[model samples]
Target: MNEIPAPVTSVGKTLLARIEDRSAVIGIVGMGYVGLPLAFAVTGAGFRSIGFDISPERVADLNAGRSYIKTIPANKIAEMRKGDGFRASADFTEIASVDAILICVPTPLTRHREPDMSYVVGTATSLQPHLRPGQLVALESTTYPGTTDEVLRPILEKDGLKSGTDLFIAYSPEREDPGNINFTTSTIPKVVGGDGPDALSLACALYGAITNRVVPVSSTATAEAVKLTENIFRSVNIALVNELKTIYRAMDVNVWEVIDAAKTKPFGYMPFYPGPGLGGHCIPIDPFYLTWKAREFDLRTRFIELAGEINTMAPYQVVERLIEALNRRQGKSLKGMPVLLMGVAYKKNVDDMRESPALKLFELLEARGALVDFHDPFVPQIPETREHPEFAGRTSVSLTTEALAGYAVALICTDHDDVDYEAVVRCVPLVIDTRNVTRDLQGTYDNIELA
Candidate 1:
């Protein structure tokens, strides 16, 4: 709520010099998926990184050279610890030791699908006591525009410490794609927007060291918008294909096959695959953030909302398909019938199930009187989620032949590479292929059906 602080050159210049020489100690808050990779990327660029987390377990794991995230191996943490490159701490007082602090916390949606700024607000409040005049604070969480200037600025400036002048404030949203082999934090180009010229320069310098490129936008709001735009684009496109999948399904056409052939054109034709529903932290959640923010100006995000509606209905449609398949194949009612979800992770080969449709599918099936269990090589036990806490503590059953035969139907929610798709087709009586993992073995088995 404070006025945008005037840019002070002296502190900004000193910080820029420190970043350039790799003398700057970077502080990364929330040592989860995004923060963990970024900390290593910072250290890889020769900067000593101190990671901060609220979880003592996470801090203990990192300090002991262990990794909770699947993609980041334990040996990598060991390598980072070799020369005291990276350290994770629960103490916020350590915030004073770092030159720049990046807030990489989650911006999850509430039950009403509204932006829950609790994590961001809580993180900033915790850092308030340790906030210094010369330190930089950059938010790497995906949020709507004005979050940096409006939401964070007021909270950080609550004590009358000017943001742009004293504490350099910036918003450089994290574009972390978990389990992405092609792009790492260092390879991804970072988009940065600062409160002012001084803040921008320091943020750019800090990110510029770790990343291959830094896209300096005009203001903090613009940077926030960049991340939302990226996720929204994917959300809309995926929704389009999901809609197409339904239309093509009624025509007895394969959406996966259509996409495979269509992508061969290779010009003005980028293929986005259809899924059971929108999953991950971004596609399912970010568009709603924009739509929620849009309501403040009394404007409706019709396209985004429609896309959201379509994606939300996806799990229901998939459940209906499973119901139909069971009735048609076995001539048995869904009531008391056992169903197995092949994968619980949001995406292939990743243990992240933040908003995975598999959980939604589980709930939907169980609500319809079907007994549902899951079998994911990646996710052995369903972790506690705010929306689906009822599913928590349920362990994944083995995909053995006897286990597969016991289920009335198997739904391939996620197409993890390690899964034996052929074995699933061989054992399961009815298979609902949402991800088309059984595309190659279609002729071999008549039991497989596309969701």
Candidate 2:
């Protein structure tokens, strides 16, 4: 997983020695899904970790040993609070105290679907004044290539601490799958690249402590490209399957059945199911970063852009299917009808709702004069989002026979295992299943409709 590491310089040797001795203080900026778990993972590797965030609410919640994420329990936070092993703060002045700083901030897309690096830029600017010699700074945010060398190196080195000589800078993308039980921060392999050989050595040494394996690469741009490439692969494949789902449905063929049988080949086949739309922090948004950056080289990422268009149109297709179902089977119009939305979280059983398709479905249905209500066990109350601020403060409705029977149809956007789908099919007059979660009950329930 590593080529020959550069011979440690005097400053690099000192930090390397601290990393081996379990005395290194690790600072993780941004205390959201990626940062919170990563800080604890560093602590688990026997280093004291300081979590940084701009939100007072987040800082306060962490200080009080409260866990806002469902995957991370409160007991875990309380355990981290037993001593000075872990603590969170909003003060960027403390950046000078840490041996290494890992940036895990958000990199979202703007209204134009361009890379929005405000969080990363702001974090780098805040910590630049406090950056000291002999310290290491590694970015873990998923970004386009050249971000570490082009964006951060200048701002961090602005205070006269030269990279590789006075300090070190590197890029190591975060690969976090929110609800996957099979993997954790410590178990997943890390991919690291640096501005120079010295920066690579120091950053690899830092990450080696937290993860079981460390994959060292040549440059920061390469590492950044690695993350984008991974998500692009998924985005393209999901789009392919989604397009297939539509064509197969028109021919009265089941896309899920085809996938299930095709996967039995066990070679040259990987199954990626179609969903209402792409979701989470990565797949739906990351591909467009490459598309946007391609403009620099006068390149058009037509394939990736096409995939994005397909996925983006998926939510609208769901709305159309719902409308068609209501008009044809029930002889009723979609206007002024009650529709129950199941699973508002981006994925199954996760509390995160970043870029979820359910939000778009809500907007589209409501715009068509349909009354919409959602039920998600994980997300009890909808928080304010930049994209869908109108949904803020709305709470999840109850999922029961009595509650389900009131709605004209139940549309399943996320296939959360905790949901009683059998009961949903029985209680509702029509059920639109986008996830194929009701595959087993497809024939048993005549009311089920696939979107």
Candidate 3:
């Protein structure tokens, strides 16, 4: 192991002492899912934090002590504002005063399925002029390896501020599971990787204050690869079970029951449930970051490719099951059949609908001439999103026995906790459950069918 680089310059030493004393001013760029909670964490640790966002509306809401995310409450933001612990801004000039800056921007995939790093690159370009010596910059976005060193390093150093010597750079991927009650920003272990010793030391010191544990690795690329590996593991496991669902169904076996039995093993077993498809920011999108980068080495990520293919096709499979259930119950095709989709926010309890398979399933059902209406307690109206602009006017339908009875079939896509499964089984004539949400009502409802 190489010795950690000692802070040689006065600016570096001053910044390190401020971090130790909890007097460091922290700047969090991109105030979305990952950045908002992180800004709160840093401020809660007694550091003065500023949250930056490109959206003026988000900045205004944050400054007014209102929270857009469901998991984070307005009271928490109010608490941060009470003591002047945190403030939200759209000004890039504030970067000059901050001792450490953490970039938590989005990295989406292009229409061609390649890495679209425009947000990350644009942020770096905007912050380049305001960057000063001795400020530690860490990227928390999920992207391909070498993004920190290759993409951000040059942009920062373009104004003659060296990375390791004059300034510091690191990559620390965000592991935010929205609606997860178990772990939080402070409780989850953070992985820190740096370009060199100085960057590593600074990153560990900064993140060590916010999180319970900080796992330091050798280089920035290793840290990037760690995040991709975790998501790929999930993607591949989910794909396996999704494929198995079809096989077991053909054999007249319940896949959910098999998973319950297989999970009984005390060792070498971790259960990953099958769903309509993958959702959330990390699982559906992160694995492909590696797949795109692997092509540079003339190699292919077969597992990732296979997982993408299977997961991508899951929405179609769910629609097919719904159609089959409808035909069996009413002896009619999907044409003119009214179907109620239960839950549209991808997963339970969270309002995030990024890459949600439910939308795709809805589209397929609509194309087949099925009248589709959805009900999600978390989401009131479907917002106009980049990937799903066509669903803009759609609003959540009220769930009631009388209203549900009017539908031909109720398709369970998300299985949110707020939904009454018993009521749905009793009211709807035919029910297609993709999430095994009606497992408890298994032999009770004659019309219930698993997808």
Candidate 4:
């Protein structure tokens, strides 16, 4: 229902020229998983990039050429800091200095499972006073369909700088996959949408310089919808596989084997493996944005709601499997037992633990009187998080054979490549493989049991 804005004014044309000429100073707000890689990509494309974060510590680390995220090396940060290519700041007043601004803030959900758009709105409001002509702003945060047009545009236009005229605005959802070595930020296709033709053209040109492919959509809302759709598809598919895993387990059939066989059919099948549960910044959270927004139209997102329900229960199912395996194999109870949890991060090779099902398993195990210890090569210690503060003091235990043998059972929550599965199977008395990490050694080890 949102109307398109006017054509590009002289100010927008000047900004476009600067962007095309590679002289534009690119500013990335919220230098976390998404923004940091983007800043690197922009700087690598021969444009000056400035990273902005509210955390002074993060700003200091980036300014010192130190990498906090594991995927981005300190050497890369040092290389970017070597001239005027990249810098980090906590000051919002410096927004006026950048030619283009990319908002990459988080859009998390409230306790009631509604969209919490405070980060996006707050960043837009903070940049309002610094709004000027000949500057382009693009929001790269994932959200509901109308967010770029409804939530951000009004806040950005409050300073008398009209979008597409005195200023330009666009929505380009970020496709950053942290710890994914197969695809870098530059390799992922950038999807850009805007209020009008000029904004779209400018956004495409700006992102096109960094990435190999730039997909331009008609409206900003459409671009926002694209990100939601992609994540929702993943969430639903993962939920399906997880649900099937339970059914297959009940029937004495291995779901991993079924998936491996089904994936060979190239025509109509796309393989999505089951896991502990959905994690990271996107899959578990982004789908609810659409679920909340759909209620406005008096429509129910049954699939999204169902997928959320199933995925949320996957960790509990894993715990049940562990309990069942322990009771049947060793005639042991969970209470007072020492259990080793392998890999605490959501996925392998990354330190991010946001909404990780492994944390849920840890909490559940402790509640059931199981003494739990975790081992993750990437995460040395559990940091204090907004959601799981109780796990703050826990640190990663060693993965030696001596340490593994001391535990009553070992649960493979995440299949990190560095973990020696053979040693784990040999040392641990009972092994609950939630990730099917020991599939190759299914018959070799008497202790290894797949969940």
Candidate 5:
């Protein structure tokens, strides 16, 4: 709903020229994990870049030389802004002034496990009136197959505008793995798919200017499916390991040690450890989008459903494991037990807690009448969720030994660097290591239980 600034018609046309001359003005929408880094990379690749976000605070942060997103550095953002080519705005109207528009917005799931395309729809619709000839539009949001053709194509082509000829449309999924220092936006090979040849050519030319390689696909649907497959593969694998964790626990064999021994095979094995549950932006949610679309073809994706089942049950399983561990320690039940949770972030290092299992664990514990408090150095504040009202707007406590010892059982939710594992092991009455962070410690008095 943002208004466009003054017409930079020459600047807009110059961006297309820059695409050929490697001086394109790249506009990245939704300046989150994928978008912000991409904007940085485009600027780094000698192209002018603009970062757009719906959050005015995010725009203000960029303008203030600060980065709220964990992965992007503050100086890199500042440098991009200080440079002539880079700018940040909340307005979508100025999108007409850019040659290439990359939609990096959030694609969340509805309550019924359907893909919520509001952000995608809003962005695409906003650009409809401003749709200029020969402008390349690539949807970088992770979505279902027909999203580009069915949703965006119609919305964009509403005003007698032909795709591929008048304006280019494509799909290129963002494969951003946060906290990954080795591979980045420039190094990661991009997947490009277009409505037609011209779209393909323009998308390829645009991305090729920044990225090292561009893998072209048949259609936008294929590109969309590729992203879904990547995340579904992860979801299925993690579910397999989590299910095994439960089975192995009943058999009294340590799943981690079993994985360790099996990992020695080296040839056919890829080790994926079990934990409290799935977190992060992609793996937990993307499969459901695919499954939802598959239903239209009368296809029931069993793996997708099974993965969801197993991953969804992980938090409850962690609570059960905590009960078992606590029972072993005090010869009593989880009722009236003081349980301390360690690390609430979705992953080990990053501060992102979206779809985190730790939040689920916290709610389940409180529901079972167990007193619970979380300690995560990376994530100081835990946001609100639909189900857990008790933990809404609560902040994470310090991971001190006193905090660890006060609880009857310490549940390791995330394994952040700031936690003093040795101290927790020595002082805590009982420990449930979800991420195996405290398994190797020697000071524990046989009180530590890894889930």
Candidate 6:
């Protein structure tokens, strides 16, 4: 491990001037879900943006006007590539051309549930060679408070480049909500902080160019903590509702109805619903990053750990519900029963399948000899997994009475707007609605059940 760098001298004035004049060349690293959209938004906002990724294929795709990320349109990439000063490449030699850089890689969890900083560290190392004076580097990857200080700072300062002084370094966490049609990269409020005043001002000025709102916190650690707090609050709240859902089920109460009624109150309560399990890159993983980092501080985050445990158990509970549903229909268990899963995408609309609960549900069902077939209109080919065969060439069937008649039981995992509830209720024999897509059609389907 290398020593962390100090902030650059007069960084605040220089960075502010450069960003104001649009002379700051923005370099975005790890152009995945978060990076790509940000790159497009920044480039479209009149700043010259350069995308940097280690994957040659990703760079090639971007240069060729092709986008692998679902939310980022290929046409947008094409427009950016053809636009005035937008370029993407795998070569680190072009890193010197960047005046500002954002690190947007995934900080995924290890098998042991520890925070994996390999990608962040690797990205820092790659950019070290081309690091120069008066450049502002912001880490947008979601991790613990000390990540910017403990992990990235050392890697960037290995060549004696001072941070906050020679090079302004900050941590401005990216709040990218994938599959969200309403809020986008430009609309969402951005949180920015850094080691000192110089780093903070630079980050604020830079992000202010793209977003309307910029929240300047005290330090980089506090900014990192902000993202974790947002995610952990969600995790804990969802776990609370999930726990309540189980109790309500035993009491013969529909949790969805309860939530709808509670939502009407509009004053004291905010509704967070239950599902098969916590899915997506943030809810399932972000809290654990905080808990893992807490251990280093000799602090035990019991709330976070307990929330994680409860949320993780939800998938198995859902499988049990499916088994119970099958037992009522056909005197047998999950074993050898053909199950059709509806919607494999993590959320309702967009096509990002990363960390989707549907995959976990499918895997759990298949482990018990239950035949599982998934249909997600957003995702065409159901790629092969560790447990399932290469079920490629599969596509979403129209949610009509005739199309769903073959399946014995249908599990509604993601409620995409295009799916017709009336048609699904009329067709599927038995339905396990995790997302409550069938709640309104309860009177229509006598066989519909809620998990």
Error of 6 at 282 (Å): 0.7
Greater TM-score among 4 and 6 belongs to: 4
Candidate RMSDs in Å, in order, are 2.9, 1.0, 1.2, 2.2, 5.0, 3.7
> Model 5 lDDT vs. the true structure?
0.83
What digit string (tens of lDDT, one per residue) describes model 5 on residues 203-308?
8778888899998888999999999999998999999999999899889988988998998996988898898889987999999998999989999999899999
Distance from true location, Cα of 18 in model 2, Å: 0.4
- Where model 1 places Cα greater than 4 Å from the true spot, the runs are 1-8
Q: Comparing candidate 2 with candidate 5, which one achieves the higher TM-score?
A: 2
* Candidate 4 error regions (>4 Å): 1-8
Model 4, position 112, has a per-residue lDDT of: 94
- Give the whole-model CA lDDT for all candidates, comma-separated: 0.90, 0.92, 0.90, 0.90, 0.83, 0.84
lDDT (Cα, tens digit) per residue for candidate 6, span 1-451:
1222222466557767779898888999988889999998898777999888888988889888888877788888877876565778788888898888899998888889998888998899889988888888999999998889888888888899887678878999989988787888888899988766778777777888899888888888999999999999999999999999999999998888899899999699999999988777898999988888888889999999999999889889998998888888877777777788988888988787667788778778889898778777888776554323544456666655666787788888998887776776687778888988776788866888899
Off by over 4 Å in 6: 1-12, 383-403
With candidate 3 superimposed using the best TM-score fit, by how many Å does residue 41's alpha carbon deviate from the native? 0.9
* TM-score of each candidate structure, all chains considered together: 0.97, 0.99, 0.98, 0.98, 0.93, 0.94
lDDT score, residue 168, model 3? 91
Off by over 4 Å in 3: 1-6
Each model's total of backbone clashes: 1, 0, 0, 0, 0, 8
Model 4 has a clash total of 0
What is the Cα-based TM-score of model 5? Answer: 0.93
Identify the leading candidate in terms of lDDT: 2
Q: Can you list the residue pairs that collide in candidate 4? A: none
Ranking by lDDT: 2, 3, 1, 4, 6, 5
What is the lDDT for 220 in model 4?
95
**Tens-digit per-residue lDDT, 1-451, candidate 1:** 2333333578877887889899999999999989999988988899998999999999999999999999888998987777889999999999989999999999999999999999999999999888888899999999999998888889888888898788889999899899889999999999989888889878887888899998888899999888999999999999999999999989999889899999999699998999899889888999888999999999999999999999999999998888888888889888998888889999998999999999899998899998888888988899999899999999989878888888888889999999888887898889999988888889989999998
TM-score for candidate 3: 0.98
Candidate 4 lDDT at 412 equals 92
